[model samples]
Target: MKLNTVENLVRPVFPFTAIIGQEEMKLALILNVIDPSIGGVMIMGDRGTGKSTTIRAIADLLPEIEVVADDPFNSHPYNTDLMSEEVKESFNSQITLSQKKIKVPMVDLPLGATEDRLCGTIDIEKALKNGIKTFEPGLLAKANRGILYVDEVNLLDDHLVDLLLDAAASGWNTVEREGISIRHPARFVLVGSGNPEEGELRPQLLDRFGMHAEIRTVKDPDLRVKIVEERSAFDQNPLDYVESYRSTQDNLKERILAAQNILSDVHIDYDLKIKISEVCSQLDVDGLRGDIVTNRAAKALAAYKNEDSVTIEHIETVITLCLRHRLRKDPLESMNSGDKVDKVFQKVFQ
Candidate 1:
């Protein structure tokens, strides 16, 4: 029998392994993939630092996830928690749901998007007339179990930001209109990037992000030349350029998948956890989010590094990313907060 297939447009996304520098930003993105509960990453960097390119590359690098076929929510076939209400009901009724492996979604929320567009609207007229509930899913529904990227997120409308904060915080998007209600999973990695020159997100929205990664333009002349040459080559012949790095991409993809599989087995020491909290306390970070995200990010890094247990090295690398945005100070300032985190991490760990 001939195998059925669906061909998606194969954009020549730059290979994640081929991305030069921005190691902090790259690592933050990878950790979120390994554990989305690290919440998500707020990537602020200078223009032309490959911030958007890196995000897209990582999205392309992610492994395909098993999902219910024809499900708009990208519902997990067996995980009722991850499934849409309709899918769950069908599953509970003993329906044999069709399944397919799909690339994890990558949703780019346009700045001009309206509330109804971001959060699906209920078809009240149809529901009342036909006596059948009709709901139209939106970007949040489509982003379920994937990556929701909002470029220039600092400039997003306050109302939209409120909607995103709610969805990201609760992992669910609810739409109610005219007494018609619909809710669906909105659990996805919320990645936002903006140049500090543009503006900054409010502390509340900034703190909503689990980690903060700051990237800078490569300063080394040789490295700058290399990045330029690589981009030139990609633009010249995207397909061939991408193919040259296929092996490296496959290896990195395998590593990420393996890390995810072993993530649950990774453990952190109680003393180390205490030190993480101490570092947060010293930083004067508000609430327990900083401490919790630090611990989770540290564990994720250890797992990504193929270590069974967390270490100071892991904590040192991830602490800054986890807590920098949570500081009560201005979020648009130069990334010296990362240095402060390092300082406190050193003092606390000692």
Candidate 2:
């Protein structure tokens, strides 16, 4: 389908605020949105707990982005495009044109997908007709500067998972096939969801995710009924329902934008930094990514609170969401990182 047409047809259904519960999951996703450099988030949960719904809701919350027109990869205008001399000159000349903002691209990588489809392959017909190798961009290319969501990620083919991990870690995709060599920016926020009961993700891949969250099916009768009613009302008239929540969504967008502006100036004090490092040290997280994400998340919380700097309270609030999944998992023992975070905060901040 045409990109613009898809934008209109598949309007994001749930506003971020409209989601019922799963606060940690929601906050982790939002933190990623605030700082895509934090890597991505993996939502592991039981089925039918709004995992996919929360993803869709996040898509809705995101404000539109502007990019170069007619660039298949949605290449940023300021970025250098490594193409043939002729194509590069044309692109350089075209850079003077005005920019526009459209919805951020959100592409789904399906299970059972072939390597060729995920990473693109040579266009055989074009090669035969033109006597030149033509490269077809894949899902990763399409998801540039946006989100690449994988449902049932644990079940994904090992090779495909490896390809994703490589691209995500490097922020680039190099396609050398059929005697053609090409490289392009393929940076994107990777979101994956799967039921833990089904299987476990490879530890290497799991560690690549900046944060992890879980959700459970609501058992309360009234809350369940509320969820059903809200969904029913939304389905009955989606446009009207979206309209009703437009203000809420706009508010969230404003907050995100404000946070982006405020994030740079928000300081992580020395004492808070030491406290955060101590907490992560206590949890025995693997690497500095935990400390980095913890610091960033604390700053984001401060931005959200309109604080001038990250305080001990901000560190206390974000430590769990940032470091929970970074802890080593032991099948024999239950590890509630939340309780650990609470204990650390009580000891440090109190």
Candidate 3:
């Protein structure tokens, strides 16, 4: 089967609207989509609270991206790779083909993945036979310009985490070994999830994430029953369940596209910007990335609400989602990050 057909079959196509309540987590993911440069979000909480579900649902909400046909990396036609002599000849000679509306790539990085598997390795047989270095791209290469999800990310090997952070920061990956040097685009929105009890992510790795959300199992009896019932019904008839919510999902897809266009025109008043910066400053976030992400998220919130301008309410709503994970650790303090953010919001936004 062709790759696109295979993707549609294996990729779990979940409707964004079908997900149960987890508003903050959902909104943060949407904002990252609006502006991928905002970096990726880390969803930390207890297991079975739908962290994976939320990440999977995001695929349905995104519009299909156009890519070069048969390129393992989904290299854009305008990419630097096209500047190479071989690729340039192919393009100039009209030997390249264009792809259609394929599903957005959302690849999972499993815990036990090997370094060679995560990053491309030299194709030994091909290199030996042809006497030329040939590269085999891996997960990071395949995940270009899309979501790279790492479940149980805190448990990932230290070297793997370092590789991820380096690629994320540079937006490109370079490999130099055994008479081969190749660099390709590796930009992606990094989404990670883990239970804190398993193991805590290192501070360096933690700081790379732009936003963090905590998802707890719903405690309310009524909500819990509804969640169980929905899952049961869906499993009994997956296609019918998916078909029923198809329109709702389509509507959300349109909204995301509209929000992307509107985001450029969405203005933030000076007062609101100052308030957001002040909240981050008061929290003593380690870098300016915190303030920048906070402002971007607040603007996204305003756009999501169809507001022409950002308001103090938007700032208040986004403050916690932006600063919670970036705060200094205080093991002796009993207060959670959310509580600390709430206290600050109440004081500043009021």
What tens-digit string does per-residue lDDT give for candidate 2 at 1-350? 55667656875477678888888888878878877777788898888899988887887678888776666677665556423233455667874734567677888999989988888887777877888767778998888888899999999987888898778767888777656676777888889899989898887778778777777789899999999999898888888888899888899899988887787898878977887787777777788888887888888778877788887767766777676667687777664766766676677666
lDDT string, candidate 1, 194-311, tens digits: 9999998998889989999988878899999999999999999887998999898998898898899899999998999888888888888989989889888988888888999999
Lowest lDDT block of 10, candidate 2: 79-88
User: 1 or 2, which is superior by lDDT?
Assistant: 1
Order of the predicted models by TM-score, top scorer first:
1, 3, 2
Clashing pairs in 3: none
- Model 1 backbone overlap count: 0
| Candidate 3 runs further than 4 Å off | 1-12, 78-97, 123-131
Error of 1 at 55 (Å): 0.6
